[model samples]
Target: MEGVFDLERVATFVAGYQSVMSLESAHLADTARRLWWKRMTDFWQLEFHYDRNDDSCDELYIADEALLHWWTERLDVVERTFAGSAQVPNSP
Candidate 1:
């Protein structure tokens, strides 16, 4: 489901998933790295917009590109969050 980025929601979702099956926190950290790498290496969105002469996915491309920057900047915090080592604000 697509929605605004919320770290707390992400943590909750991960915790929920862990309830069903065991997942190593280290795995989450590794997955974050892999995702970042994939984002860094991918240009499909740009290809679609520029090469394919399509604008339908422009907004998505922009959002994802921005997200890549955001994620890169907060990579450490993200890894910590995934590993349950960072403190997330308590939900009200």
Candidate 2:
């Protein structure tokens, strides 16, 4: 996995968000799963770089795809970290 995105950063970000915004652990976990699924099913990055001949988002696409794999391999840890970081009350 690339160093572009990591669990610690995500956890820290979620914790920071919780300081100002109220978030539910289940909601966050669900959203993360959905996003991962979307990426798993999408070819937009390839389309963009090949079909559309645009390379502007290449780096982002690469990073996101890498993160997708990273997250998939650590789904449980991701959920737990997100839940803990968000400090959501009584999340299952």
Candidate 3:
């Protein structure tokens, strides 16, 4: 699923598997949410400060926005794909 760009089908697959996995690990679901939100908010991709160039300053702070988005989306797919494994039991 990494040759050409396909968003609609991928999203559908992710959502579908996510629904199935909803019955599995609550921990992974929660973690997915956190990661999704973190990437959404902390999108400081390709940020560079030429004025303050130093060893401490990173040439590329974080990933490019598009790359980050793709990464986040992949996480969703992964979370859904493997959501059935190592599920935590629900409390009584």
Clashes of each: 0, 0, 0
Winner on TM-score between 2 and 3 is: 2
TM-score of 1: 0.80
Determine the backbone clash count of candidate 3. 0
For each candidate, the alpha-carbon lDDT, in order, equals 0.75, 0.71, 0.49
What is the C-alpha lDDT profile of model 2 across 1-81, one tens digit per residue? 472345676778888898899998888887877777887899887889999999887888777777777667767777766
Point out the worst 10-residue segment of candidate 3 by lDDT.
Answer: 83-92
Query: For model 3, how does the per-residue alpha-carbon lDDT over 1-92 read when each residue is reduced to its tens digit?
Result: 33222444444555677776554456655766676678567624323354444434453343345545565656655454334442222221
Highest lDDT, which number? Answer: 1
Give me the overall lDDT of model 1.
Answer: 0.75
CA RMSD of all predictions: 3.3, 5.8, 11.2
Q: What would the per-residue lDDT of candidate 1 be over residues 37-89, giving only the tens digit for each residue?
A: 99789988789888999878877876787777767777877776776556765
| Model 1 poorest 10 in a row by lDDT | 1-10
